[model samples]
Target: MTATVPTSALNLVGKVFKPSELRFPAMPPLGLYIHLPWCVRKCPYCDFNSHLAPDSPLREVGTASVIPLKDARNPRDEAPLTHALPVDLQRRYLDALIADLDQQLPKVWGRKLHSVFIGGGTPSLFEPALIDELLGAVRARLGMPMSGEITMEANPGTFELARFEGYRQAGVSRLSIGVQSFSDSHLASLGRVHGGEQARAAVAAAVQLFDEVNLDLMYGLPGQGVEDALADVNMALGLGTTHLSLYQLTMEPNTLFAAHPPELPDDEVLSDIEDAVHARVAQAGFERYEVSAFCKPGHRCQHNLNYWGFGDYLGIGAGAHAKISYPNRIERETRHRNPQAYMDEMLAQARPAEVRSLTVQELPFEFMLNALRLIDGVPDAYFVERCGRPLSDLQGALKAALDKGLLDPKPGVLKATPLGLRFLNDLQSLFL
Candidate 1:
């Protein structure tokens, strides 16, 4: 038996909400990204926002000389073999990072951090105590969950057992070792400061220290053959790393590699390397969850997953970029690219270097660009939830993709088919 509501109560309950009164859907899980912009030396084939360590002895060396002098550190020096991370500069930067977070906190007030990624040029170069202090500051301000994943990107040349142990003690649950290649020739060709031996040592230390470790490897490198590429994968597998980020070397504009391109493997060899990497990692019980990302079961990178899922993240550091969601709109923000400028701006409490809201017409492509990268595409509901629109809005593009056999024909899932995954760019272009 149901009791009938009064007409007046029913009228109030069924009242239509005005467009302005309706609130946007709740935001996705949030993460934080802290970028350290200085590396011992910048790689020629790299175009990330990394720069050489300031005041290093090799600062004036020609780009071509970077590789040869990579291992020229004085053996007698008891200090860490890499370029020194100035204590004062580190303090200033950490303070600036805290201030930056303070400015961004209101946007995510009361939200717990899902994960944190401390990435960049060579985060391992900083002292472990400093890393601890940085993390402490973040935890104090942001309120990270006890079980949240905190990852720090480390380079082989700066590997130190004590340093790594200290990082583990300082609450870094994961370590991403930049072991680009285990082949000495390939490492040199890529302008890496560490050789095969140092890379191996770094991985060994990371595996022993952290429960979750990711080995970053690049194939199709200059003069690399299928055998060389396979060897790298095999060696990384042998190191017991739980995850791998395998990338193909590309020459981007404004990079030294673009100005004077190295002799890369031909198209055929490049294809072979890709094929071999896929087969080997799969055979070793790893799943290619996303493009360029392979991982053992339960070991996927949460911070990266947040990005691919179009979740909100606050990036606080030099040259860091962020995408945030609000009740009415979504916007992106970026910090100053120059380290000093970023610090100065943060100290001055200035607005972010840039901020822009995404127009409705632009949301679909931007959302798909990230979501479709995953082998298992995002849920259909996310299309409407994250993009602030109905799925019908994408009917034309979806129909075209299905007609071309690029999208799965499932009723409620938005995933690419095998053919679509192979021609990912073309498939994604349909959204635009």
Candidate 2:
């Protein structure tokens, strides 16, 4: 067997760095990302780092009495609070996450957060009180805006008026309900617990409390026809949500569906569904901003927009990932995936992160990869603002792509033509 490489040997630059040389820039318009990694049951199509409880032996643990984790410099800062579970149930593991964030805050203490998103296996599984406490801690530590966007992803089955209201009162201004599809067969095939009616009720509750409500719908399911997918889109629009994120189902590695491949719709049917959904959504006053996202005026998800625009964000919790912009380059970091492993690493005072710095050669392609996702391509100047470079930086590759008619001839800006968007891989390959 090949000799094992040390963790430090696997630096982001593929080269080892001395401690003194390792520094990241003050992240830009920072945002917070919290991952909740537990689920009642795992979805076959979901490749997210999540797991269901197993028949394991007993273990009673209490980090509650332990001093609440605070930022190293700002001792007054509060963090997320977790629900207490009996010895038999799985723990929330919030203490470890708070400790991890505390250790990271010194690197970026005074930055103002643009958004905060709580995503998960099922974020609603956490008690509303825990969410309230978490947001309270965020405001105490990071100084969020009075009207900043706070979004949480939830499942339809886990809903109550009190909990929804608590989330609003806790400072959450947006809600993204995971209503993958309205068809019972589609929902069942995806192993989703909620039915069609449950999705409706969940949207109703969210609309009542949050100013921005988004529905997460999935298309191109196993055995799903174009008409079936269109029906799902129509049903979601009827709910009157401000935003909708319709994703084409992808069979990612390690997912149950990948291991046992299902009979998915052919490319023709998939294309039909995409065309139908796009037309219907446009006619209903919703504009297709991102490839899979549709929104009313000013209703786009700011957090996702930041991501696509290559903005900075801090990710916390097991399996969370983050990207930060520094003076000369961008750095990517990831937390340990295992809950137990993350806690152990945090409790030992060792950094539970791995970092990488990007090179000049990689920046242009990276910027275009994200910016081109918008329906209307970004202005030429945004490249410099975000990537800290100019459009002329990648002239050779741009000229090649332009000669191939893959890019529009719009001076100072790069826009993908219809053919380019269809074969984006080929267009992007030129940059690579």
Candidate 3:
């Protein structure tokens, strides 16, 4: 293979397509994304689609005051809201998720879901029985792969060994435990409820119950020195997890962090922290695949891989996002943000989702943003299969990236070299 792999091979592998000629097929490989919005408390450095509701709201918004209405003239107004409020504020409505699933599942009947990922404020806080019910409904309605990857995001403080065993019985095969950091000060700074010991115990429990288990860790705290960051990494490596998601503490918009910014480490210190942690993780036999993810052989998170590889997924629950690829269309969907709103909408048996199509110009960037994350990278066939276009379509831009030595020289793979990984944005910009 040449230093720069030829884009022409993509043309030979599949049908050629221009921006205008591209088409998105329905039923692109399916996955399931379940969102749990509530958290015990908010983390300062976190910006996930999560909410802080120490106590779950009562499910009492319905009946005479609030009614679901549909007008004959306005088809899109099927989910019309009545100008009335429910009298009950004391009722809780978590079961309303079933109503939402009942309404939506029929629309995508007969599709195989390759993976199911339950991410949340803290899914571990929910009763194990509820988890079992949720999984049972999923298996009955949307068929699961014979050897599917079923993952649930767990909080170390709320995690119980017996609960995990019950989850295994409920068909959950993977656990993504959020340990954040093992340092007492770091955990306190991040507002995490779990301690170092709890995190360790959670990992031990998860490894015993699930076939694959992932630990979530964060670096770049407000006062996190490089040594502090390394200590956290060392604790994570000691946990014996099969997978690790090491995220940098970024201050995103709309969060408390954005409003009341903390004194984060300087850029130079941050860079050193990243480099040292990366080196330590690699030395411990974990391969860095995505920017923040590392895993042992055959233990990479399949659900996340499906997302990055551009596979289709159905989002359920509050603030969930989904991408669906039909034979002639690709659409993204999102549920209501508030848990109460979501439960109400689900109870009424409405779509609870709005959809939009991806435009042609946006495809290359989205495709590359995901596919290039793997260290060894994906094969050429994956580019064709995932992007729904011949690999040749990206030749001109990819060639520029290869020439810049930002990409690996492998013919079948699309990996970033060390320098490329460092300057990933610059390489990605070529495709954009």
Best by TM-score: 1
Candidate 2 or 1, higher TM-score: 1
Query: In candidate 2, where is summed lDDT lowest over 10 consecutive residues?
Result: 66-75
For each candidate, what TM-score against the reference?
0.92, 0.83, 0.84
Candidate 1: clashing pairs of residues: none
Error of 2 at 326 (Å): 2.0
The TM-score of candidate 2 is 0.83
Model 2 lDDT, full chain set: 0.72
lDDT tens per residue, model 1, 1-432: 011223332233323434333224556678999998888767777778886776444432245432553443323444454546677888898889989989998999878788999999788877888899989988898877434799999988788788899999999999999888998777877777678887898899899989999999999887788888999999999989999999999889988888888778899889999999999999999999898999998899988988887778999888999998887888899999999999999999998999998877777788889988988887766665665555555779999999999998987567889999999999999999
Estimate the Cα RMSD of every predicted model relative to the unseen true structure: 5.9, 11.8, 10.6
Please give, for residues 282-368, the per-residue lDDT of candidate 3 as tens digits. 999988778888988778777777777777788888888877776555678888888888888887777756878877667778888
What TM-score does candidate 3 get on C-alpha atoms? 0.84
Global lDDT of each model? Answer: 0.81, 0.72, 0.71
For candidate 2, lDDT tens digit of each residue in 1-432? 011222322222223334223222223457789887766556777889765534212121121121112210111122111221222233336666667778778767667788999998677767776777777777778887533799998877566677788888888899999999887667767766566766778888889899999999998888898889889888888888999998999989877677776788999999998888888899999987777789998888888877776777889887889887766568778988876687778767677568887676787788778767776666655555565554456679888988888888887456777777887878877876
How far off is residue 277 in model 3, in Å? Answer: 1.9
